[model samples]
Every structure is written in C-alpha cells, then in structure tokens.
Target: MPLRPSRDVFITCAVTGAGDTTGRSDKVPVTPEEIAAAAIEAAKAGAAIAHIHVRDPETGKPSRDLGLYREVVRLVAASGVDVVLNLTAGAGGDLVLGSPEAPLPPDPAGTDMAGAEERLAHVAELRPEICTLDCGTMNFGEGDYVMTNTPAMLKAMAARIRELGVRPEIEIFDTGHLVLAKWLKDQGLIEDPVMVQLCMGIPWGAPDDVATLSALVQNLPDDWIFSAFSIGRNQLPYAALALAAGGNIRVGLEDNIWLAKGVLATNGDLVRRAVQIAEGVGSRVLSPAEVRAKLKLERRW
Candidate 1:
C-alpha cells in the first residue's frame, strides 16, 4: 500500500496517567483542579487532545474514584479549553503475583484488580470523546505486577464504550496486542475506523528500536488509524518517527519528564516541543476540531 502524504497530524498529550509517579515529581497533578489546569495549559500549548488519568487527592496515589474523575471533567469542561478529552479506562487491572513459587496468590502491596465495570465507571459517566481499552494482558515490568486484560474484559469494555458512543483508543503495547485488537474488530466489538496507540519503550513489551517499530507498523491493518510514542528521552524523537511512518503522535508528562537532559518538563513544555518537532517535519498540527472530525469522535458534556 502506498503511504499517505504528510498532512495535518494530531498531537495527544497524556496529561497524567494512573502511575505512582507523583512523589517523583511535584509537577504531577494530584487534585482534580490541578489536573484540569494542567490540561488547559497543555491545550494552550498546542495539544489537540488531553489523555487524562486521575490521582488520589490525599495520598497522591492512583485511584479509580468516580467522584475525582467527575471533578476533573467538570473543571476541564468549565475551563473553556478547546481540547479533546480522552479519559483512561485502563486502570484497576494491575495483578501482582506473590513470587515465582507462589504465583497463584497475588501480592498485597501491588495487586489492584477490579471488575471491568468498576474500572470503567469514570469513562461511563464522563462520556469522554475517547477512552483507552488495553488490548491484552502482559507483564507490565520487571516487577511482579501484570497488566490484566482478559478477552472477556476487553469485549465487555469495548461494547459498553460503543454503546455510550465513545471511541475506544485501543492501547497496543506489542504485536500480540494488535492481533487482539484486530480480533476485537472482527468480532464486531470495536467499530469502524478504530483508533490505536502504539505504546513503546516499556519493559516486557516491544523495544523502542526502528526494526520493532517498523514491524509493528507493518503488521497493523491498512485501514486502522494509529499513533505511536515512546517514553522518557525518546519521546520527542518518536514523534518524528511516528509521523514519518505515516501515523500520528502522542507526548506529555505521562510518558516522560525531562525537557532536556537535566530540565524537568511541564505538560505544556512537552506539548510545545512536540508541536515544534511535527512542524519541523513539514506537517501542520491538527486542532481539536480537526482531530474530532478525523477520528469521528463525539464531544460530550
């Protein structure tokens, strides 16, 4: 298939993910107001979409509290920022095992498993334009924790999201995940013009090398709309590579922190830098409206 010429590309800033990184950086937003403000800042900095994940207000830890999500969404909606809201439905699935000898039992400190409905409560109520659906189960990292996404769970979530008229941003961490995503499509769980995010550079998943990225890209269905990004130092560079590979780009504090070798990054800084990179490659950055049209997303209240 012939590659599409560079046109306006959309940039999604994953503002704050459900990770335990709040202690690592004070810039990470904990309160709903802060998350909304950070998202607004990112929108002003040229982010077409803001992928959000709420944190616990008191402990600064990841939480699946629906009220917190509601507050964040309300604040963002009231902020008057022209950015697409992409809430995460990928939390509450971490399953950390005790040890190699006792893998049947889960580790208390790491396990945070919940039912699919419970996991997606925020997305269901908020009705964001886009929500992530992790494609399959995988070892999250060297730690005992495993990112659990059973076939049944994925199907249930996808069906519910479709019913709510929310687009599911299929999160593909490896080639196998893409296979599962395709299967979901074949099973009529996912709708036409499916959106996917090629997550790279995480441990126990596909490495952040050209060969791996190219292979993953090649394996994707011709009609699938996809974007790609790597974590840490390679985040900006991956923006260029993803565009060159005929895909979109994603970047933000959720994936990386350093603006440079030693400089800590704000979400806006990362977004502004990504915009510069995309424009440098002769591709105009898409606005929130453009992204909505391209992705066939429905804006919610």
Candidate 2:
C-alpha cells in the first residue's frame, strides 16, 4: 500500500517537563493549577495532546509525586478541554553518579533512581490516554549524568503500561534506541500501530540534521505512527520537515522556550505558531477527538 498523505497533522504540546527549567524562566508552570491551565491554553491554541510532567510545588524541582500528577489531571479534567492527556512515564531514571572517587556511594544530591513500579505509580493511577516510555539510556549532557533506561526496565514498564490500558509513546533518542524499541515490539512487549517520538538535538544523542532525521524515519516499522521535534530554533522548521516527511509534530517549552531570540514564550504561543506553520504548508490541524481516532488513543478517564 502507498503511504498515506500527511493531511491531518496533530500537534502535542509538552506543557512542562520534569526538568530544572522552572528556575530559569518564570513562564514555566510549577504548581498543578498552573500546569493544568497551561495545558488548557495549549489545547485552545490548537494542540491535540498535552504532554505533562509535575514538579515539587515548593522548590520548583522535578518530582515524581503521584499526588501532584493526580491534581494536575483533575484540574485539566475539570477544565472541560477536549485535549488528550499524555502523562510522563519517563521519570525516576536519573542516575547522577558521585565524584569519580566515590562513584559507588552515589551522591544523594544527584541520584534519583527508583524501581519500575515506583517510577510508574502515577501512570497506573491516573491512566492517561498515553504515557511515554524511554526506550533506552544515554549520557544526557554535562555533569557525567545518565538517563538510565535499561532494556530490562523498558520491558517491565511496557508491560505495566499495556496492562493499565494506556498506550506507550515510545521515546527514541537515537537509532540504537529505535532498534531496541523495535525489538520490544517484536517480543510482544509493545502493541501494534506503535507510537513513537523522535527526540532530536539533545546533548550526546541524535543530531538535529536532515540526514539523521531521515535515517530515523526510514527505519521505523511500516505501520507505526510517529512524530518528530527539535529543540530551540529548529522547532518550527522541523515541524514542516516532519510533516513533509510523513509524520506528526510536537512543540512547547519542554523542547524550546523562545518564540524569538530574547523573547520568552508561553506553551500556547508556541503551539499557535506551529499551527500557523502547518496550515501554511497545506496541512490541517487535528482536534483532540480527531487525533484520538487517528492514533487509536483511548479517551480520558
């Protein structure tokens, strides 16, 4: 069968990821209310899905607290927006090693690894339409830090997510990660019509270039549905590129912050601009219901 023409492009706004970005910008939502409001705004501005992550309310640090996630979900559910909720199952895997001298001890200030069940506590309870599963591990920038997601852990999490009746949006940072994702699908750990997110331009992972993007796209399974996005200035351009290459798109503060140089951006603004770009390129934006139908996503609980 010939590839389907990219007409109904869906945009997912990553409202606020579990990162230290809260401290850097006042625009980053910290509390559950703020996060939920931001997600609503993004949905109103044309995002079909809202990718969410909660934080410590007091310190504004990334957190895996299930209560925080629950509150955010409740608020969004009450807001009456029709956006699909995609909770982050990508936390609790940070392995910040100690000084080279004391690597065995694992610095308390840095390390935050947890068991599989503990990591996915929120996903099990909240049961969003979708939850991300980082397919593999990689050195995630400066500071000798590693985003640890071993194959064993991935299989375990994938099984749990499937049991919860939540679709796993497999996050692939590199070609090798995609390989592992394919392996998991082959082993029946993941389901058919697999959804993937091509995370590009992170430190020490896939480069943000056409060659790399094309290679990743070419390697995907025939029936899989996927989306792609790049960080910073590459965000808008990559939207067009991804759609033209037969995929969906993602945008928001989790990946990029500025609407323009020296200008801060809100999640809604970022999403709106992406919508404009998609429309300009002869593609129609998909609503939440449309996206749910397109990706076979379950409705919110």
Show the colliding residue pairs in model 2. Answer: none
- What are the Cα lDDT values of the candidates? 0.88, 0.89
Q: Write the per-residue lDDT of candidate 2 for residues 1-301, one digit (tens) a residue.
A: 1234478799999988876787667999999999999999999999999999888889888889889999999999998888999999888898888867877777678678998999899998888999999999999878768899999999899999989888899999988999999899988988867999999998889998988988998889879999999988898888888888788989998888889989989999999998998899789999999888877887865
Alpha-carbon runs more than 4 Å astray in model 1: 1-5
Error of 1 at 249 (Å): 1.0
lDDT tens per residue, model 1, 45-88 = 99998999888899887888899889988998887778899988
> What is the clash count of model 1?
0
Scored by lDDT, model 2 comes in at 0.89
The pairs that clash in candidate 1 are none
Query: What TM-score would each prediction reach against the true structure?
Result: 0.96, 0.97
